[model samples]
Target: MKVLAAMSGGVDSAVAAARAVAAGHDVTGIHLALSRNPKSYRTGARGCCTIEDSNDARRAADVIGIPFYVWDLSDAFHEEVVEDFMAEYAAGRTPNPCLRCNEKIKFAAVLDRGMALGFDAVATGHYAQLRTGDDGMIEMHRALDHAKDQSYVLGVLTQEQLAHSLFPLGDTTKDVVRREAADRGLLVADKPDSHDICFIADGDNAGWLREKLGDRNPNTGGDIVDSATGEVLGHHEGTVGFTIGQRRGLRLGVPAPDGKPRFVLDIEPVSGTVSVGPRAGLQIDRITGIRPRWCGTVPEVLDGPAVTVQLRAHGAEHRAVVAVRPAGASSEGAPMGVASDGSGSGSVEIELLEPAEGIAPGQAAVIYDGSRVVGSATISGTGRSHALAQTLQRVAT
Candidate 1:
């Protein structure tokens, strides 16, 4: 197979590209230039899209004896991932920018260009496995190292993309990968891993937003309302700084029955209201997601099949019954029934057997059957089921 290996100038990508070459595939390396003006020197350890990273990638490609080139996708990255991230935060919703990057730039843009250039697939350092089943469909699964599992970030990939995707670091642990890179004489064997959002240079999220969207704070000095009494508790900087389940940084004076810190239950960017309540209010039983994307095979219908649901990246997974919610169904109301035959307006609902916390709207809910990722969607809204629903009526208000 003619493969295009995406080198991130990291040990993982270098090793993945070398493995692809070792497999006797016609491999070429392409480094994505996401930043228009990449910094000359590394700002601490954030080396994701730096100019140094591209240089490291070129050096690694030289070591692997493969042709290397850098593709500039800064415009697309700024529009799709960075701008959308700011917009989502302004709307008081937490979004996964990493997943968005994988969906739009890497797989969609790069894979399309690679295919047009006669490359069979685009290989990456993602910690995911691709298995060919008897049905001849490539099934994506979790990596062998659970700590470095990146399947969550790549959940938005569809069947077509997975068909042309390769993750050579799947079955190997991170330690082994680094050792192998060292053995192969790769310079990035001891390179530090990049953390946080790449674009946010200083690694401060709210600070970066304030610097970027100056004088246009989402909260606009709005009142923080108490969920129980509907009374104004305090004020906040902006809604962008607060997530759904965040407990600290709220600085609300409201004291719980047990004297615990109040957690942020909801944030209304339209009304500029931040609702604070007890930690129990964060428990979510039902999650409704929009714009669902599948991998390997698109099931004709998802008739309430049991699957595991991961709400946040690197967060805990819970047992859930996955189904399609109706079109006319209210986003504020609990899902009434399932939309059978997989014929719906691209909405998905996951009912957790054990209630999960921190289910914020605009987050991605990646569904899995065992180790294989079935599909994923952006969380539209969440609700409590059974007896807990009545007690949490304050959530609707």
Candidate 2:
């Protein structure tokens, strides 16, 4: 079988490619040049597609005795991932660009191109296991090393993409993977892991946005309003720095009703208004999500059985009842509804066992049935109409 390995100049990817070659598959390495100006990578920060990183990937591919090439997908990355990131933030929602990259670039665009070039599968350094279930359908599970598990970021992948995907380091820890790379003389073995968002290389997101959108940006910041009484508490420069469940840097001199700290309960980008209230205002017993993407065929039941819903990356998985309408009967513009049985298909309404905080639109809600990933959807909106009381818990939404 011909396989294409995505080498990101990281030890994990280098080892994944080596494992693919050892499995007797005809393997080739490709480093995606995601940034046109690779030299502009942040000082003392690690990121993908850097000129230095690409060189390291090429060296690793050479050590593994495989043909290597750099694929320039910078334009696509800018359009799909970078632009989408800015748009989501500008729209008063937090977005995970890594998930979008996997959904659109690595697994979709790169896989399609590789398949057209006769590669049977596209292998990556992602830490997630693909297993054959009892029914013979491919299932994705958390990697053995939970700390390194990347399944959450990959929840956007469809079954078609998973069919030809290979993850070689899912069963091992990061330390061991680096050790293996060291044994094979791969230079990235000692390379630090990439931290924060890759595109925001300096770890200064607000600064980066200021550069892109400028001072007269449309989604510019506005007043921080009170969620309960609609009174303006304070003013903010931008909403990009705020997300749901945020408790710090609010700088709101006014105290809550109980004289406790205030939290960001909601953000309205169109109106340039932010709603602040007690932390309890973040709890939502009900959630409405749209644009559901299944890793496999849509499940047989329109109404879901009990499942675990993962809202944030590495966030706690909460027990919930997820019900989908039949064949997408729910219009995209329709208001939120109760997650009752039957009707729409592509959308889901989730009822959590316990009210969760930090639920935000534009975030991915990945549903898991046991260890296998069932499906995932983007959060369109959240509701605290059911539980508006102030409550704090160890688990975050």
TM-scores, all models, native as reference: 0.90, 0.90
Can you tell me which runs of candidate 1 are displaced by over 4 Å? 40-42, 215-219, 300-306, 325-345, 390-397
What is candidate 2's lDDT per residue for 302-375, written digit by digit as tens?
Answer: 33454788898889888888877544234674433322211123677887877788888999998888767877
| Model 2 worst lDDT window (10 residues) | 335-344
User: Pairs clashing in candidate 2?
Assistant: 159-295, 325-344, 325-345, 326-343, 326-344, 328-345
Q: Per-prediction RMSD in angstroms?
A: 4.9, 4.9
Runs in model 2 deviating more than 4 A are 41-47, 300-306, 327-345, 385-397
Q: What is the C-alpha lDDT profile of model 1 across 1-397, one tens digit per residue? A: 9999999889999999999999999999999999867772135435488888888999999999999999999999989998899889988899889999999999999999999999999999999999987898778899999899999998888778888988999999999998999999999999999888888886678777766777666655577888888989889877787889888787766566568778889999878889988778888898888877777544433434446888878898888888864445457763333232121256887778888887898899998988888878889999888756775566545
Look at candidate 1 and give me any clashing residue pairs: none
